[model samples]
Target: MRVAVLPCCLFSLAALAGCATGSKTSEVAQVRMVFPVQAPARPQCDAKPLERLALTGQVASQELIDQALHDSRAAHARVMRDDHVADASINPARLNLRVSVDNRIISSSCG
Candidate 1:
């Protein structure tokens, strides 16, 4: 009975080894490789139409607003009377004007 059991265990292990070594070609065929591409840089605000304004913390006035609009060639301008920049509602092609509570230009950005 012991001799018979030894042969059976050896056969089982041999079968498992055969199954483990069965195939690598199928796995290699199933895999694919990919490459990445670089993206273009965005244009700066100074290069656009709003370059004329003093920007950052400057006093906001009607004349300055008009000049910015004319220089930027934007369709229109919206003033946000907050100490911080507001959520973006303007079009990406338009200009975003951020102003302070005291009517000072906080900063300017192009959407």
Candidate 2:
């Protein structure tokens, strides 16, 4: 009877220890999978045109701007000074037009 009881006690303790260790490992793995690491920020000046439009260095016309805006599918469109264009927010669904004082399009970009 004593021998049998000793073996049973040892086996129970081992099973408990194994379960505790396994649960900890699984919890850590779950946390790592649920939380993702962030990537590096992209450059601000790397904007690209959403559609093919001959806008750069051209006279800014309402018709041309409207066409460009339509093609871009931007949620917001704004005509800003050429100098202020660099400071504009680059949004995937936004379009920015850098125009000179004479209403000529100096540059255009989309995110």
- Tell me the tens digit of each residue's lDDT in model 1 across 6-111: 9999999999887766655455545532334457754333315465556677777788876776677655667777765667564644566778788888777666
Q: What TM-score would every model get versus the actual structure?
A: 0.48, 0.46
Which candidate achieves the best lDDT against the true structure? 2
- Candidate 1, after superposition: displacement of residue 45 in Å? 9.3
Model 2's alpha-carbon lDDT is 0.73
Write candidate 2's Cα lDDT for 60-80 as tens digits. 788887777777656556778
Candidate 2: stretches off by over 4 Å: 1-51, 83-88
Which ten residues in a row are the worst by lDDT in model 1? 42-51
lDDT by candidate, in order shown: 0.67, 0.73
Task: For model 1, state the Cα shift of residue 8 in Å.
Answer: 99
